[model samples]
Target: MRYSKATDYALHTMMFLAAATPRTTIGVQQLAERQHVSPTYLSKILTKLVKAGMIESTTGVNGGYRLKRDWENISFLDIIHAIEGSASLFDCSLDHGPECLIQRVVTAAEEKMETYLREQKLADLAKELNLMH
Candidate 1:
């Protein structure tokens, strides 16, 4: 399984917010510049993140966006799920096509991966990132 660039950016964005001081807003342009992503590209990801309640936004001067919850309260899986929806790893259609040998293996792997991701909170990821403001 692979994640789209959108998912990668969303995850990176959340980690940035988590690493920032709580309740402080960061502009999308600033975020994009730091992450080396296009502002227009980041905006699309931010919109979805905000709509999902993972992030909050404001307008006008001194306005930008902030995390909706504490970093410890969020999860990597939550961000992934918010951006990509459910952790559906297998396409049943593949099994329907022909004799698939690894369907069962793939299903088990997906389940294991999902469980690992769910158990891993964003805070856990931050610890690994060591992202200090």
Candidate 2:
């Protein structure tokens, strides 16, 4: 299952946010520059992250975005769900209903993926980034 570009961008952006120092904010322009995307596009992704409670947005001369206090507890699944809304990548369009074997197989795979994602915390990578900086 393929995720959208927005999800990819959000994940990378979040890692950067997670790596940042406490209370320090990164502007959308700067965040977008790394991905070679426009600031306006990244702003929408930031808004989703803010609404998901993974980050906070500030307004003023130093206005930007920063990770929340509980960012260390946020998992990859959390960030993905924030951008993708928990929708399944594949859906059986036939009339087989819930008893479809294909559906069962797909569901099982999705569950396995979800478990792996849920176990991986964003803080894990951020800690490494912090050490390197």
Candidate 3:
């Protein structure tokens, strides 16, 4: 299942933060430039992440954003849910009837997808990409 562009940016932002020096704060503009996303759009995404307690934000000369928790503690599903709210791979409308077999299958698939995401941590991703030092 394809996630929204905002979710994609959020993932990239988190990974970038995770790969950087621990506790090093980065501005949204810098993050946007690195991710090739619009600063305005990235700012909104960062807001949601901050609200979710995934990232911390500060204002002032040395203020910016940083990961609020350890990379090992943050999972793909966490980032997904933080941005998308409920990581449902498929939207099943009950209009097809309450007992639709297809709905059951889709729900099962979504569960599996979520489980896989939950097992994937940001650290793992960084290591896979050789971004971790």
lDDT of each: 0.81, 0.89, 0.85
The better candidate by lDDT, 2 or 3, is 2
The C-alpha stretches of model 3 lying farther than 4 A from their native spots are 94-98, 131-133
Candidate 2 per-residue C-alpha lDDT over 4-101 given as tens digits, one digit per residue, 9 for 90 to 100? 99999999998877776746898888899988999999999999999999899999888999999878889999999999999886789995877999
Model 1 CA deviation exceeding 4 Å by range = 94-101, 127-133
Which candidate comes out best when scored by TM-score?
2
- Give the CA lDDT, 0 to 100, for residue 43 in model 1: 94
- For model 3, give the 10-residue run with minimal summed lDDT: 87-96
* Total clashes for model 2: 0
Point to the candidate with the largest lDDT.
2
lDDT per residue, candidate 3, 1-133, as tens digits? 6789999999989998887854789998899999888899999999999998888999999888998755578999999999999845666666575478888788888888889999999887877777434
Candidate 3 deviates by what RMSD? 2.1
Instruction: Give the least accurate 10-residue stretch of model 2, judged by summed lDDT.
Output: 15-24
lDDT of 1: 0.81
